[model samples]
Each structure stands twice: as structure tokens, then as C-alpha cells.
Target: MKRLKAAVIGCGAIAHNCHLPGFQKNKWCDLIAVADPSTENLKKAHEKFKIEKAYTDPLEMLETERPDAVTVCSPNKYHAEQAIAALNLGCHVLCEKPLCVSMKEANAIKKAADKAGTIFMVAFSNRLYKGNIVAKKALDAGKIGEPFMIRIRFAHEGPSPGWAMSDWFYNPEKAHGGALFDMGIHAIDLAAYYFGKITHINAMVGTLAKKIAMEDNAILQFRFASGKLGYAEVGWTSKQGFAGVEINGSDGALVVDYSDSVQLVTGSTNPSGKRVIRKKVIEKNPTAGGWPIEIDHFVDAIRKNKQPEMGLQAGIDSLRVALGAYDSDKKGKTIVVG
Candidate 1:
């Protein structure tokens, strides 16, 4: 097994929480460097991870280290530029979600990835969880029949305490669309990935939080190419928990409750005219280490000369869903997503 040298950019909650720890545990990776604009963040990451090479500039690290791959954990605004820079430098890049602040920038990064012949991917770690994967398997087994509606809910008490230090994530200029871009993108991508390409969207957004300028809540409805209807509700306003996703189809239904356990229903109908099925509490693994899969996947793509599972084009397609939702919110009309 070839161990790839990896560098992480934007040492914040995402870096500390997922990328660093994930890389630390992975035998296929050598966690080399980390870069952030904040000296405080860099010092903390270096100390915690015992990383020797820490810089305040990503480009500086890229030029000096020439890593085999890099993870861009920066604010939504910087995703495209930094990923493109890494790709141009002949390194595979694993970018965090939303892809970028806009579709134009998303396309730029995709083009750069294509031209450079390097792997570029967005770290959509939600799909890596056991519950999600199991749910997908059950659906494909025809347990869910023809998929119809998808109901998704992803929320947290708000950004973690670590987020206070990364205030740029809340700024409209930096984050593009607040909770919508932050938490909503994950649900959007996961839905599109399983249900198929999003063909249309209708959305409404509002800023309900006192401190945050961006929409703390959003409601979006999407039409998938496979003729599935989906609804996603997101909010930083939730005081309950993180999130969950439920898929309903004609023959049966699947519910992945992140709070409890993953459930599947099929076969005989109950009093409520719903199928009665089995539910299981598969051990809840840690989410903090999901980024390693994204890292390893990108590296494998680089080594094999193939596009990654969540390639640049997939990122672009996912971004369009959120962007279309935003457009719908602004124009108060449904938007067609290509």
C-alpha cells in the first residue's frame, strides 16, 4: 500500500474535527502539513496533531511541500480558488462542501481539475456513515420499491463552539448562504446522489437567528430526474440534535434516524397502512473520522488516473441544487436546475 502525503488547509472545526483525526488513524496516509490564516488555529492544530509543518498560507505550503493531495477545509468562499490552485499544482484536492459560493466558481474549479488531470472532490462525509450506506443498499434491494419522497432533516444546536472562532463562516460574503450553504448542502448532495440528478427546485429562506446574518433556516423541494420528490429542512435554530434522513417509496420505506437507529420497513402492512419491518441500532461510529475516506478516495483516483466518486462534476451538479434553491428564494419562483 502506498502512503500518500497529505496537507490540510483551513485549520478550523472541520480540520480539527474530521480531517486531522481521520488522517491520523489512516495507515494509507502521512499527515504532513496544515495551513490556516490564523496563527492561533495553526498553533493549536500543530500542537494537537503534532504536525511539524504548519503555515498561515496554503499556497506557501503547496509550493514548498508539493503534497500528493490536499484537503481544502476553508470557508465556502475560498473553496474553488484553493482547490483549483492545488489541482493546478498537480495535487489531488478534497474540498469541503457547497463546492464554492457560486456556480461560476464551481465550474472554474471543475475546469481546473479536468485540465490538470488531477482528482478533485468535495468532502461529503454524510454518505460514508453506516446508516446511510445500509439505507441505500436496502433501497436498491427493491425493499423500497419505486422511490417517491425523501424527507431530510439536518440540524444542530448551532455551529460548534469552535465555530465562533471561524466567524467568516457566518458572513454572507464568505459563506454564501449561511445554514443553507453550510448544513443544507450536505442534505442536498446526499439526496441528489441517491435519488438522482435534481431537475427542479423551489425554496424559501429566512434569517431567524439574532446573531447570524445568513438564513438560519431553509425549506427546499426538489424534483429528481428519476421522478422522485424530495423535501429538505435545515436550520441552525434546532436545539434538538444533529440530523436524519427518511426515504419513502411504494413497496416500503427507509428511515435513517441519526439520533436513534436506522430503520427499514417492507412486507406486510400495519394498521396505519404502512409496512411493518425490522429496525436495527448498528453501532454509531464516530463522524469525526469521515474525512479520511474522502482523502483516501481522492488519493486512489490520483494514483489510478480516474475521477473520484464525488468528482468535480458531481460537486458542480450538487452546487446547482443549492444555487437553484437560493435563486428560487430570491425570485420567489421555482428554478430549473441543469
Candidate 2:
């Protein structure tokens, strides 16, 4: 019932694929405008979303349109500035993740969010999907019985020449870390969603495939506050294979396939002294990624005037692990993520 004006920054793949479309479909939102540096991207946004106003300068757009909400889908290098700008304007912001490339920028944005008093959510889309929801609920209900470990693999054939508008993802200065920061953050946040706070982290990262300045692949190991162990294998070079999430627990193991299916495995002993493995499909909702649900959740948080369940703090925590992984890779030693 509360239809509010909303604008978006960066008209790249994320903006066109999710942010713009999500705002368009939400009845409670009026898709007002968009801002991007590229004329081609702005033209596409206009032709597709039929946006009335577009700006090359996002700050000018924010000042002029003054939308009630904004989604930051810009490059990793620009997230801190754009997000801080929107938050300072007292607008709800759903920032795409790996929050920022550095802790200094992260700290600055945190202060701004603290002062803004508006809902700020990090776009950790993987955790909001149906399969993850079912797995989380079952884990909470003890269906998994004292979950102790998790493994999540999210890999793809790189962003450039495909999903990304630009090749900033391959630039170490822009992206900070390659697949580790890009795809790995999602896995890291999803791990935190199920296991809570992460205490220590170590990783192996390198540019194994594409000749990029940043790493194209990374393997991260995490230790949660609950003493749970987790590993995430993220890369931008997988043509085909496993790229889903799994959690192993005391009772059984829960697996969420790449296509949104949750399977639980429990073991039994046969009379012949052989071990038996039984698999049950507990939830299956094959769909695209959780961008729409994530946007809807952002809007709902605004309407309810409540801080999001996973807000800036969660973003910072996940970033800590991600940055720590980079450090671990550099030092060849585990890093304390306190």
C-alpha cells in the first residue's frame, strides 16, 4: 500500500537483470530513475525499464530525484562512495556485496549507516533462496542435528564477455580480489547465515585460468564461533561441475544443488553389517537467483521501519572473512578474523 519512489545506481548486468526488474515488479515501488556513466547502459535502462530520468552523475540524480530507496549495483571499487552517498541522503540502500575493497572504506560506510537511521541491506542473495531457506529451517529444527560443517562451491566461466558490462572484475585494483571477492563473498555470507559468526579464516587463491590481475579461483577455510568448520570453493573458471552448497551434521548431511533442490542424507546399519545411505528430497524450487526476493525483503524492511535481518554488520563480517582470505593467501598462514 506504500508506493514509494525508488532509483538505482549502475545499469550493468546486475541492474538490468535484477535491480531494475525487481523494482519494476514490486507494486509498492515506483521505479523512478537510474544513473550510470555509460550512455549505452543508460539507453538500455530507458528502453527496457522506461525510466523517465537518467543521470551520468549518481549524486546529481540522488539530489534531484531524491528517491526513497536506492540499490547500489556498481563496481566493487565504487560501492563505498555510492552507498555512503545514498545513506547520507537518508534513503534505504541494498548494496551489492563484498561491501568494499578495504576496511577503511568499510568503516566509513559503517559510520554513515549508523547516522542515517535508514534500512541498509547487503545483497547476499544466495541465503534467501528457497533451497537455503528449507535447509536453514531444517538445521534450526534439528533435522540436521548439530550441524558442524559446510561446503559451498559457486563457480562460473568468468564475468567478462558474458554477464558483466565491464571487465572491472578482472582488475585487481578495482575488484581487490577476483573470484574470491566476487563469487566467494556470496558463499561466505551464506555460510555465516547458517553457522553464525566466523572467527578464523585461511585461503589459497590465485589467477589460475584467465590472465587477470586478480585471482580467478580461491579456496577458503572458515571456523565459526560455534566451532563449526566450513569450506567454500569459488572460481570463475568452471565450465561444468558441482557448484552448490552442502552442510554435514551429526545426524545427516544436507545438500543444496545448483538448481535449487535440498536433499538430506541419513545413514543406517544393515543387518549384514553394511552401511546404508538414504537420501530424501525435502525441498525443491528450481528458479533463478534470489535477486527479486532480496529486493522485496529490502522494501519490506523499509516499510516495517526495521533494520534488516542481514544488514551492514553482516556485510562487514563477511567482508572481514573475504579480506582475511586474501591476507591468508598472501602470508600463507591462517588469519584471525576477530
TM-score of each: 0.91, 0.96
Q: Give candidate 1's root-mean-square deviation (CA, Å).
A: 2.6
Candidate 2: stretches off by over 4 Å:
269-273, 286-289
lDDT of 1 by residue, 50-162 (tens): 99798888999999998888899998888888888899998878898878878778778868877887767778888777778777887888877888999899887567454
Q: Give lDDT per model, in order.
A: 0.81, 0.89
Candidate 2 residue pairs in clash (backbone atoms < 3 Å): none
Query: RMSD of each candidate?
Result: 2.6, 1.7
Show where candidate 1 strays beyond 4 Å: 160-164, 267-289
251 in model 2: Cα distance from truth in Å?
1.1
Residue 25 error, candidate 1, Å:
2.7
lDDT of 1 at 38: 96
